[model samples]
Target: MATHLITGAGSGIGAIVAERLAERGDELWLLARSAKRAAELRERFPAAHTLVGDLADPGKLSWAFGHQSLPVELDSLVHVAGVVELGPVGETPVKVWQETLAVNVVAPAELTRLLLPQLRLARGHVVFVNSGAGLTAHAEWGSYAASKFGVRALADALRAEEHAAGVRVTSVYPGRTATPMQRKVHQQEGVAYDPERWIAPESVATAILTAIDLPRDAEITEITVRPGR
Candidate 1:
């Protein structure tokens, strides 16, 4: 069975992905920011491993990716950990902007950097769970959009860098998903954004699994899933 490493595995799309992987009998390493959530998932999937570390911290993420004594190497790396900082551009705080980039951009790039060796060993796949915001711009979403744009750019570069080495990178850009991040975006903006009625986490998870399970010779660079409604 393939061994998959998923960040932001504590909830929503991440949680759904983890569940589907486990159901498929794949070995899993679920990374999250909360010990409680990790522990709960561990209990739910006894065979899966859990690590609670803040991706925003390079040192912490580094340790979780490599320093931990593991009997198995990861065959797939899915970066689902990201933040959405929404506010009018002029009112958005510098710290919040930095934090959003830290998780959405820096963490994925660094984690991919560290895990590439392992992925190369297994001829594995890398998945980036980015946002449509990464592809399109909007008002009051400058920081979040910038970070996701960085994510899109990073995935593009990594795919090129590792293509010859048999490591494939796929970026999944979903629009207005019903995840906590979307709820927060709407709450902070004080608006009614009901795009969630169409963009389900399970559908995105299915698409990601399909991408990862594709033949090594088939490289699906990027896919955009928008809410039907």
Candidate 2:
């Protein structure tokens, strides 16, 4: 069974993906901000290694990973932890912009760097759960869009640098999904939250699983999932 590490594994797309992987009998290492949720996941998936901490804090992440007796190799590293702070460029707060980039971009990059040795050992896959915002910017989404764009760049750079090492890097650009984060976005936009109008997290999770299940020799560089009209 493949050993997988997933950040933001407590909720939304991350939670669904972790559950699916656990069901498939893959060994799971889950990182989330909630200790309670971690405990619940540990109870549900007895073999899972759960860590409660903030992904944006490199020190905490280092401590969590270091304190654990994890395997030397990992089959996949799925980066699903992210935050959104929506506002037009002129009106956005500097603090919000900083936090957005710190969590959505820098944290993932640092975590991946720390895990590169393990990923190389297994010739594993790195999946970034990016958003359609990463592909195209929209009004009032300046901070979020910019950060996701950085994620796209990060994935592209990693793919180019690691292909020779057999470490496949994929960036998944999923359109607005029916997630709590999407609901919050809708609230900010003063629009009704309609599940049917958005992509389902499960669909995105399925796509990620497909990427992970591809032949070791094949790499799906990018995947864009949009809601049907």
Pick the TM-score winner.
2
Cα-based TM-score, every candidate? 0.93, 0.94
Residue clash pairs of candidate 2: none
How well does candidate 2 match the true structure in TM-score terms? 0.94
Candidate 1 structure quality by residue, lDDT tens digits, 144-223 = 99998999999999988898889989999988788887788788878887754759899899889899989876988898
- Cα deviation of 59, candidate 2, in Å: 4.9
> When superposed on Cα atoms, how far off is each prediction in RMSD?
1.8, 1.5
lDDT of each: 0.84, 0.88
Off by over 4 Å in 2: none
| lDDT per residue as tens, model 2, 18-105 | 9999898999998766678788878867889976667666556677777666657999999998988777899998899888998899
| Candidate 2 least-lDDT 10 residues | 51-60
